[model samples]
Target: MNPFDYEVDILPLSVEDGGGFTAVAPELPGCRSDGDTPQEALDNIYDAIGCWIEAAQEMGRPVPQPRRAAA
Candidate 1:
C-alpha cells in the first residue's frame, strides 16, 4: 500500500521540545516521525508509515485501511 494513502496529523514542536515538527499517522498507533519543517516531517512520516506496515505484516498483524474524509 502507498504510504501517501494514509492520513497524517502534523504538529509543531515547541522550543523546549527541540523545535521540530512531529508527524503522526493516527490510524497506525505509534507510527510517527519528527523533522525540522512541516515538509520534512511529512516526508519522514511517509517513510514511517511504510515501515509500520512492513513491520505489522512481518508480525502477522493486519494493516488497517485508510479512512476517507466525507465529501
Candidate 2:
C-alpha cells in the first residue's frame, strides 16, 4: 500500500454532457472523475488515485499528502 492518508470531501454532484456523474477532490488540482452513477464515480476516482500514485512513484516524483488545510 502507498504510504499516505485520504479524506473525501462530499460536494454537490453535477451532470456533464453524455450523462455521467462527477465528483471533485477537495485537495488535489485536476483530480476529479466521472462515472455512470454517483457511487461508480466514487469507485472510479478511488482507483484513479491508486494509478496516480503508482505513476508518481515510477517517475521519481513525490506524492501529495491528503491533509486537511488550516482554516
Model 1 lDDT at residue 17 = 95
Clashing residue pairs, backbone N/CA/C < 3 A, model 2? none
Determine which window of 10 residues in candidate 1 has minimal summed lDDT. 62-71
lDDT of 2 at 49: 69
- The lDDT of model 1 is 0.95
Q: Each model's C-alpha lDDT? A: 0.95, 0.63
Runs in model 1 lying further than 4 Å from the true structure: 69-71
Q: How does candidate 2 fare on TM-score?
A: 0.66
Q: Which ten residues in a row have the lowest lDDT in candidate 2?
A: 1-10
Report the lDDT tens digits of candidate 2 across residue range 1-71.
Answer: 33224454434454446676775665555667777777887776777667777777799988777775423
Per-prediction count of colliding residue pairs? 0, 0
Instruction: List model 1 lDDT by residue over 1-71, tens digit each.
Output: 77888999999999999999999999999999999999999999999999999999999999999896533
C-alpha TM-scores of all predictions: 0.93, 0.66
Q: Highest lDDT: which candidate?
A: 1
Tell how far residue 50 is off in model 2, in angstroms: 0.3
